[model samples]
Target: MRKLIFALAPVIAMGGITLAVAQNATTATREVYVKARPTDVLSSNLIGLNVHNNAKENVGEIKDLIVSSSGQLSGFIVSVGGFLGIGERYVVVAPSALKVTYSENDKKWSATMDTTKDALKAAPEFKYEGRWSK
Candidate 1:
């Protein structure tokens, strides 16, 4: 009984130490916000951005980013052209398609797409007077 009590004492002490340590641990909650500088933000580097069409071709590059009145990025204004920027038409792309990535080899930013250029051009152009969401 004495030997058993000695062994159990150390085990009980260890359990107490563990409980004390656990009680002493502190927990914190933090909030983080990620914002990009207007100058640092570029239309060319957005990821998963694409111009898609029912015919499956990418038409052109995104010309500008549109934001909400509350300052959140809403969509992309894409410019599609066949003979350079001269004949381009503008379209809006959903923000879901855009992602951001870094490239070590090129040492520059690039945008990737799940859709082709031809497909993008095939999509309907945004009418100047109408909301893109429509």
Candidate 2:
């Protein structure tokens, strides 16, 4: 009926306006083009990389990376004291604690930490439960 159409007109117009605004906002914020710089290392490359201490002793391996809601690197999850996925403990290390480097000639990437294997094992463990569980 005409009365019904009149009642819904404002709502429909508001929806259309809201949709247009959302589209424009998305376009403005979205990255349409991106390039990988030489200094940047992919997360896929870092994950599973073995971490060693200053003396080159095996400490742990990077299992996962924690990212904040604001798209910031929060922590690196390292698995320590594990043999073939058996008795490993997971610990969240600070982003600055692990040093990552790339070698062009060797075509390899390496990660190093200042702590030892026993130190990492003694640190607080992070269980992949609750929100972190698959």
Candidate 3:
């Protein structure tokens, strides 16, 4: 029994030290507390927002957001060429191609693309293959 205890002494001490370190990590105060935005913009809120062209014309509404497996933004699906949601096509666009800005007077975030409505409508449409989601 004494021989067994001696052999386990170093292992027991190492485990205790590891537990203490883990406890210290959890109890330590956070040094960084930065906020993402002054106003909390929910992902749900952005889903159906109006999408506009650079010409200030109401082109379409945001259909969906495409994200990669790594959680990076892949693109946006803008519903174009639709009259009240009819005859509309969902087009995928590069995220960097659009400009998103907050309007202080309106108290809302607006999205704008440099391309025209007709141009976006002519682009390739987005279709789900049942394997991936928007």
- Give candidate 1's whole-model lDDT: 0.47
Error of 2 at 28 (Å): 3.8
Candidate number of the best TM-score: 2
lDDT for position 11 in model 1: 12
80, model 2: CA deviation in Å?
Answer: 0.3
| Residue-by-residue lDDT tens digits, candidate 3, 19-75 | 011111112442222344443444565688787876889877777776554344567
Point out where model 2 deviates above 4 Å: 1-25
Count of steric clashes across candidates, in order: 15, 0, 0
Candidate 1 positional error at 113, Å: 1.8
Better of 1 and 2 by lDDT: 2
Candidate 2: which pairs clash? none
In candidate 2, what are the lDDT values of residues 7-96, reduced to their tens digit?
111111110111011111124344333454455666788789999999999899999988655345668899998689999999999877
Off by over 4 Å in 3: 1-36, 132-134
lDDT of 1 at 110: 43
Please, what is the TM-score per model? 0.49, 0.78, 0.66
TM-score of candidate 3 to 2 decimals: 0.66
Q: Which pairs clash (backbone N, Cα, C closer than 3 Å) in model 3?
A: none
